[model samples]
Target chain A: MGESILQLQQIRKSFDNTEVLKGIDLEAAQGEFITLLGASGCGKTTTLRIIAGLELPDSGQVILEGRDITDWEPNRRDVNTVFQNYALFPHMNVADNVGYGLKIRKVPKAEIERKVEQALRLVQLEEYGKRMPDQLSGGQKQRIAIARAVINEPKVLLLDEPLGALDLKLRRQMQLELKRLQKQLGITFIYITHDQEEAINMSDRIGVMHEGVLEQLGTPNEVYYQPRTSYVADFVGNANILHKNGETLAIRSENIRMDGESVCTLDAVVVEKSFAGGQLRILFRLADGQLLTASRYGIDNDIQPGETVKIGWDAKDAVKVIDNDKDENQR
Target chain B: MTKTKTKGNSRRRSGNIGLLIPMYVFTILFVALPILYLFLLSFLQRAQVWGVDFTFTLDNYKRILEPLYLDTFWQSLKLAFTATFFVALIGYPYGYFMARMSAVWKRRMLLLIMIPFWTSALIRLYGWIIVFRSNGVLDKILMGLHLTDQPLKLLYTYPAVVVGMVYSLLPFMILAVYSSAEKLDMSLVEASRDLGASSWTAFWTVSFRLTLPGLLSGVVLSFIPSMGLFFIADILGGNKIVLVGSVIQEQITKGRNQPFAAALSAVLMVLTSVMIRLYRKITGTSQLEGML
Candidate 1:
């Protein structure tokens, strides 16, 4: 319930007659880390660009700090963006790259140097100030990019999958680093990413987008546990969807337990068992020939493929969604 | 078995050396031999039937150091530099436009640049003459507008020579810069702007610096050929100006002093090599492979 630092009022954008952002209505509270999470081509990056003033929305206004900045140029707007590729200047060393914005603003040289040092230290790259981008590792370059944006001290920081280029381990580490940076800076963060785990880990609130529309917006648990749409449930986490008497029921794979202990059990056969790290994803074919997946934690029991198994979940765990046919009719 | 392998390697090496013999012969005949001949002629007083009295003197070098010939060389250098400066000034923006243009528009622009190249250089020079001569297209149009009573004296001047040289060498500069600009990652510019720099600052700090190699290559392409070229100066300068190239031509054709011309040619070659070496040093690029 903090003041809204950024708002997109019915924003829409299209490219070459193809709509990319149908009508996105989003608001970010001051110092809140909000993530626009969706799959590729879901208008998440477009929305982030619109907020950064890199792309002009077709209709509606982008209000920043309670001011309408729809026509403001990127530099005039009090926002900075970190691109997915890092886009670190290859010709510049890390210090110059981080101090570029300050130099552009004609800040005092001494103050610029001090802020650059502080920014580099925040990203844990104090000694890499002299290294060119090509000489640094991918993670180091990503940190430099973060330093470059954060050094500006903009009102809102826009990140378009900033860690998308890193490998899995580095990406996880940088995700935590970014979260810490956001908390320390206490600035509004408008982040866009296709990675659901990243959104859940870093964001206080998440907006799920699908095909240029903001499908659902809520906290991570709200979006994951109580998705209003099937796309949201499937996109946020693993969900087993079932059509029961025209209502769409989505049950998390982990919620389905071994059959004997539950009151509602369904007869199914284990078709495929995949050992994925600490959990096993068991694929089962129900009696109605519907394929469903159940995630069993820890090392899976010695259940072979083509073996008969009974799986069940409590009826209360099944969250019913508005049927797609009815929703399409409403649209 | 290893001895046999070694023997086979040596045999392959010898075969490769034999294959290189023709390449060496061609280079000696076409390149090295001419340069050696020029060097020998530069030091000779005159040529005899078989050989001269084997007298070594520095008169050819000293003659060029005199005021008249030295003035010509200095003027030529100044003109070449001016032409090269303008070529880069116009070509960078043109090449940038080409690089950022859509595929169809880029092709059209590239064709526009190359249209003049399709005709002969001599024909183009003649066309310029027709345009700039007294009572020519330009003079006629100016007079028709009552801008001047007499035709402007623009047909034969340093500016005319510079214009001709720049017009001739511009395509080379554009093509050189375009090759580099085409490969640049445009996202970097966006990133610069997104990180709080204006478009102008981003262009200078990110885009321009990245395209430095391209600009250097363009300058070299325009400067070197324009330095040694005399036809444009002779045709456009009304034969009143003398450059190193004109001196060489005059010695070979009218002056009938082959040795002096050869010496001047050798000097021009040395000047070109020095410029190239200086460029390589300044840009931190390698000479073996062309600039990237």
Candidate 2:
């Protein structure tokens, strides 16, 4: 990350009487990969669209590279977008689609051809230059769309869940590819996605959004180990939230142990057990009717349901988080 | 059990083909037989009375090459070209904009375009007559606006016939362009804009090229029919305009020479097929039939 390159200040938007975004403020440093993470209808996509100049906020300021560009046309802004559906021009071949921005700027034919070839090579689709958009597979189309957007050498690239249409395996491959491309080009990326894993995996900082408000913006470690709010804790990863003595606390599922020396311990019953992804997860219920989950490596088939057990977690692992129930009620 | 089910399906498939017999008969008798008879009549000699003689001759075909008939063909081509030009000019933007509208407005506009089809085209042409006639709706508006002190005598003119042709055939062009325009993905246009192209550039490079098949189909639909709509010329241009259809009608009814009329019709059919072939070559698809 370098100097601040883009900023959104007090952005608010409403559509047909439904407030889609409250006042949102954010800053992105140059060459930074920031992910807006949220579920559907959480205003992440709308925020991306606003930054891309596809949508205008009801009241806000979008500053790009120290310029107030809130009213600038999309073409006039120094930003490009990779749409979710990979909106390639069906009438044009892969080379033409990649070279469209250069052609629009009246770049010489030879230069555009050379740059298009270089861009296609960057995306590892050099031999697909003559193929029409409909002839390409979904993953290939996504790469072409990225090539097309990056060809303009935009200052910032906005991606609206560009890998959402791919399967899980392909999506993981593309996530690594996109991170590599962002680094190789040194272009700032503002990505929007509903998948927290993708956000945590690829982002320099993840902005966890919920109900038109940003819950927290921090590094993946900070967001995971030390979430600022209960919503962020529950939404980011599996957590065992506990409330005691008028205070809210959260502990990672993996932090709780079946039998270990710890700062706090409780006697409980093993209520349920399941194995997934080479890990054994067991649910424990205390006499007070409070449920806690504990995860361990490998399948521990010896632990049967309804058996007596003890659960313990260190005090350092339990982080106090703001209970948003009252805040949500106020809003 | 599966074998018996497949056997029953095969029997039903054969029964389905059997049900199409009336359609085949209707097509052969009404469409195929008339065209065959007309082709045969074109090669036969005209009777001294009111029927074609059985004797074969090439005179009727050669008679179409006469200067008077050639000029009639030229006039027909000219008027049809002009009408198709205006139809595309007005209908393309009308349809493209209509597609960009909201769904409710799109449905309303489609309804507006289709309402004319429920009425007889002749009656609609008559409505135009009331507008184009001297001291009619158009002249009254012009005079009331003080644009002209006297009636413009717009009726019985070439422009009036062109107007009639366009008015009668515009919905075809609009509907054709609308169907393709509605299917065009707007995100592609947005992608173009996102790639540093302006709105106008995006429209020409992406939107226009994508919808071209529809526009060409609309042109063909309007062009082919305008050449044969003799009633439009008869009602609007009075005796001033003479098209190939008017000449064919004259040879059939007034001249009582069915062979010559068949020869004229055969030439018109050849011309239309040539146009359709050219359209197919340009679009590389049989989209003309789809438009029809």
Q: How accurate is candidate 2 locally (lDDT)?
A: 0.91
Q: Which candidate number has the best lDDT?
A: 2
After superposition, candidate 2 runs with Cα above 4 Å error: A260-264, A267-269, A285-292, A329-331, B1-26, B289-292
lDDT of each: 0.86, 0.91
Predicted candidate 1 versus true structure: per-residue lDDT over A1-331, tens digit per residue: 6798998999999999999998899999999999999889999998998888889999999999889999988889889888888888888898999998999889999999999999999999999989989999988888898899989998999898988888999989889888989999998998989999999998999999988988889999999888888788788877888776667888889887775785547788999988887889898888888888888877748888888877788888889875443575442
Residue-wise lDDT of candidate 1 within B74-110, one digit each (tens)?
9889999999999999999999779999999999999
Q: State the DockQ of every prediction.
A: 0.72, 0.83
The superposed Cα distance between candidate 2 and the true structure at residue B49, in angstroms, equals 1.3
DockQ of 1: 0.72
Against the correct fold, how does model 1 do in TM-score?
A: 0.91
Which model scores highest in TM-score? 2
Q: Supply the global lDDT for candidate 1.
A: 0.86
Question: Which tens-of-lDDT digit does each residue in B1-292 have in candidate 2?
Answer: 9999999999999999999999999999999999999999999988998787999899998888899999999999999999999999999998888988999999999899889989998898899889988899999999999999999899999999999998888888888888889899988888888888889999999999989988999999999999999999999999999999999999899999999999999999999989989988998878653264
